[model samples]
Target chain A: MQEQWTTTIRPVSGWLNINLAELWRYRDLIALFVRRDFVASYKQTILGPLWFLIQPLFSTVVFTVIFGNIAKIPTDGLPPMLFYMAGIVSWNYFSSCMTNTANTFVANAGIFGKVYFPRLTVPVSVIIINLATFAIQFVLFLCILFYFTLKGAPVHISPWILLTPLLLLQMGILGLGIGIMVSSLTTKYRDLTFLVGFGTQLWMYATPIVYPMSQIPEKWRWLFALNPMAAVVETFRYAFLGVGVISTDVLAFSFGMTLLIFCIGVILFSRTEKTFMDTV
Target chain B: MSDTVIKIENLSKEYRLGTINHGTLYRDLQSWSARIRGKEDPNSKIASAGFKVQIGSFMALDDISFEVKQGDVLGIVGRNGAGKSTLLKIISRVTMPTRGEVKIKGRVASLLEVGTGFHPELTGRENIYLNGAILGMTKKEIGRKFDEIVDFAEIENFIDTPVKRYSSGMYVRLAFAVAANLEPEILIIDEVLAVGDAQFQKKCLGKMEQVSTKQGRTVLFVSHNMAMITSLCTSAVLLDSGKLRVRGNTSDVVLSYYTQYSGSPASFDFRSSNKFIGDDHAMLISGSVVDSEGNVANEFDIRNPVTITMRYRVTRPDHYRFIPNFHFYAPDGTCAFISGPQEVTTESGEFEAVCTIPGNYLNDGTYFVGLALSSMETGVKAHFYEQNALSFNVKDPIDNVPTRNGYAGPIPGMIRPKLDWKIRGVA
Candidate 1:
């Protein structure tokens, strides 16, 4: 009699076989991992989750002092604190999600070596945890926005503010995409590990996190738009302070790039998850 | 016939040795460029000067194939580097095999290491949820069994404390408790019971026994403890150096495992060998198993006497008396008995010691002989001790004289000695 099997293990799976149903089955694991990350990071610290707010607040101050006063960089005629806060809040979310997910394979090698679960759950959980942190920082940004609007500091809240969720989703997908891709390579070539931190730092400077896109010449602004993060940061500023440029074509292009990178990342990640234990 | 729950077919796993694929971008680029140029890899050991590199790849599992029926506890026994863990990893989906396939019919929960993904910073209750989720249990499932798990681990008072503060024993107990509560259809355990105390191990064994026998869950176990394998597993497979060596009933496979590692050759000829097993005083010449008729043989009848003969050369003849003894071991590595004569040997150039085991005394199974020589004049000084130097098998025919009495089934014990018995109708 022919027998029916629930699981068949083979050498390699199809390239596009992402196993979405399995990922859905392990959604609880993802939630648990997110909780572990949140609780474990602040176990003995005095500040605990408050650090989420303090980090961006301190960075916004530094940027306001250095770029707003000393260097005299333009923020499209908006308040330096509000402008830097907007950019830092959004940029922090994307960068943290990317770096954390980039270390997924290496950080959890101990657990991964011992058991079997949907490997995608780790990176996905990282995005969720960073999203939680981003939510806290976003509230901080909203309080500063409310104060500036009350003070009548030339702020305009546009209808584009409704696109904030879409913006966060795009950043998450982009971060997960680039993160797992690098993680897959770092398994065999450990040199990529050192590059991730340095590369992300440089990547942040390339985006319009400090200076407004108006500071760049019109000819060179397209080059900045090539960075998917630039559109995210620029669109975020335009939605909140009514400063910086926003174009439907650039937004569409950036979203397309995010999806494309996400597909590639998933492909590389699935391929690496199978036999990475050997090389790792 | 029972349903086949797991079917493994010719699975093999190969791992790259030394540095995997150059380990760095520079070396990897060098190799890649050389490959494109039709030249040997520049980063390869062959291209380097004055360096000897081991083989590029090692096969951890080589063409192993087996099947497990429903509710069958299959024990996998082998020494270290015997492909047992590799096979388990492949089946657990923790690693991919280089070739072949494995089809499993139901949910498999593998305890390759207990408490995997358990964060020390998390409290016991929190870690239970985390570790259970990692082992493929949902949140609601863990919550339903949370009380039972805590009770089984016996850490009711410390359930709220972080596991990092718990003692090692308590930690293992808690970890095992969570795993024991897992209700997967197929359980793959790899030496996880080697931890914990004796009482905990017994509890774990009882739980496993209940899971397989009462609940009808299939189990695949890997362990070095032969006694546990014999008691817990109905059948077993033996692996040696990445190859399947033996597969059969647990008793027979365990016997093969012992004989395989014991290196028993049925006879030893030390006369022509330069590396002698002795000091300057005495050297062993030869040893063999012989039947009652005095002809050299490794098989003996249950009703006939078996003799073990050892020849040795005494270079320094003196008043120091030498004693030669033979230790007979049963199949399970337990010493059945020790036989030696009280007579002393002095002023001897060459000597032969013969110890005869009477008929109908030994059981029908393979037995190993360990030869030794020692002098007791000045002190207990061993001249030579060769463990498992020779082995032989004793056959028990169904029509055996008066011992059987028409019973053909196996009799359980280390020795099956026939004794005189008288029965009368007193009732």
Candidate 2:
């Protein structure tokens, strides 16, 4: 009788063959990877998971002192502390996801060289871990937001708050796209490793994180539209604090650019993973 | 006959020689643009200056094709850089082959290295699940075998401790236990048994044997240990210089592998050879088998003791406690026994270690002896291991012997030791 082979390995695979079923089958591994990252990062530390909350809080205080107090950046008539906290919390999720996922290939090269799992699982787990951190920081943001509203500060919860999940999805996909693209390039050219950190720091300025989009001259405001993260941060602030410039055209453009980059990133990532072990 | 489970066709993997990078991004971009413009690579000129012939790609595996059937314990034997690992890597999907295809049926869990994704800070129990998942086991599957895995590793008390805190032996045991519990339809193992203690190695071998026989799983095992490949494998293939040299029954392939490489000579004189075998600690001079009369010989009587002697020079004496050992192997490559001195020597200079095998101990067959110098001061550190260093034959005379009692038929076993027997007829 002729036997049926379940898997056939060939020299070349289709460029867009992402193997979603195989990724689903290995979902448990992705969960374990996330848990390992969460547990290992805080293993020897005294505070443990509290560091997740402490990190964003510390960064907010620094931003409040340096950018708000020192530079005298306007918070669009909102309290400087609440304004900077919202922007820091929103920007932290995207930046952390991008920076962490960018090191996926180099950091996990040890395990990747020996086993055959979906290489995408590693970056996906990175995003999930960052999402969990974002969840904690988001809770902290809400507690402070509740205090400001109870004191009857100038804050409004807009109907656009319903777009929070969509905004998060866009940030995740955008980070994942840029992250995997850089990771794939670094496998062959290590020069990219040095550039990722510097590039992300510059990118935060390009997005309207510390200053509102209104601060940019109207003609140069179009330049901000080119950055996919600009829309995510502005929309997040508009939904919670009720004071940031956003338009439907900009949101649609951001979503389109995110999809485009994500497609390119997944294609490049899938192709590189098959043969990266040889070069890595 | 069982159906074929794995079919590899003309599989080949090519790798570029020398450094993978072109030193700088400027040169890389120059080469990339040159290629796009249909011009000769400017960087190739610089590379060809020093590396002329070595600048080209090298073939790690060359047109290798083989088939593995269900329940067949196939052994892949070859020298280093002979494409054994390349073949396994292709089959395991860890890397893509440059040419050809591999069609495999059912799940294939390859233990290329144990504890591949194990976290150092994770407890033993958590690492078990993590490692199991890395090897393609689901969390549910790992949970089901959790107790059995801890039991197999024999570290139940340390299950809650982080793996980094466990002893090296304990770490290896736990790692191997998780891999051994994997129930893949096809298992590929690559010399992972070379770790752990001797008793654990035996247990792992037994477990692998049961995996192939009782579970009816196809297994592909690669190891430099001839005895392991000979006993554990039902069929074996010999690869030389990235090419298939021989494929047949285990003993025949192993015999050809030895003859093709080491030549199975009667004696070795490393003193005259320019190639060195030992480290700065000690070096082997020569090894030979001798008769009772003290003359060098390769043939011995079954009833007479045959002495195997090793001569070596120890450069550093008091620094290490050198333990010299010899491994005796039957013609089929199954290790007959390993003998070493009970006491170690700390004195330096020339030393001759002789071990005598009494008559009637070895069965009538050809035997090969492997020599090694090791130190147990810290851990088991082998200075050098030269396999098939010397070979000899034991012959039994047809004349009636008291133990034989007029029967001339051949006796079966690794040895033929004479034991006291009492004949009391109860009937």
What TM-score goes with each of the models?
Answer: 0.90, 0.82
Per-residue C-alpha lDDT of model 1 across residues B1-427, encoded as one tens digit per residue: 3489999999898987777677898898998899899987867776657555677788898998988898999999998999999998888899998899999988888764755677889999999998888889999999999999999999999999998998887887887777768788889889878888899889988988898999999889999877678778989999988889898988678767776787676677876666588888898889989887788887788888899999898888567788999998875568888888989887768889999998988877778899999888878888899988888877777695456778887676778888887889998
Query: Which stretches of model 1 miss by more than 4 angstroms?
Result: B34-41, B48-56, B271-275, B288-309, B326-341, B354-369, B390-427
Top candidate when judged by TM-score against the true structure:
1
DockQ of 1: 0.70
Chain A TM-scores in order: 0.98, 0.98
**Per-residue CA lDDT of candidate 1, range A1-280, in tens?**
6678999998985786688999999999999999998999999999999999899999999999999999999888889999999999999999988999997888888888888999999999999999999999999999999999899899998899999899999999999999999998889888998998899999999999899888888889789768999999999999989988889889989999999999999999999999888878
**Local lDDT at A244 for model 1:** 87
Q: After superposition, how far is residue B359 of candidate 1 from its true place, in Å?
A: 8.7
Residue-level lDDT of model 2, residues B1-427, one tens digit each, is 2488999899889999888878567789999999899977787856656555556788988898989888999999988998898888888898999899999998988774645677899999899988888888899999999999999999999999989898878887887788778888999899888888999999988988898999989889999887678678999999987788888987667766775677666667876786688998888888888889998887788888899999888987657899999998875568889999998988889999999998877877668899999988877888888898888777778575545667887576788887778899899
Candidate with maximal DockQ: 1
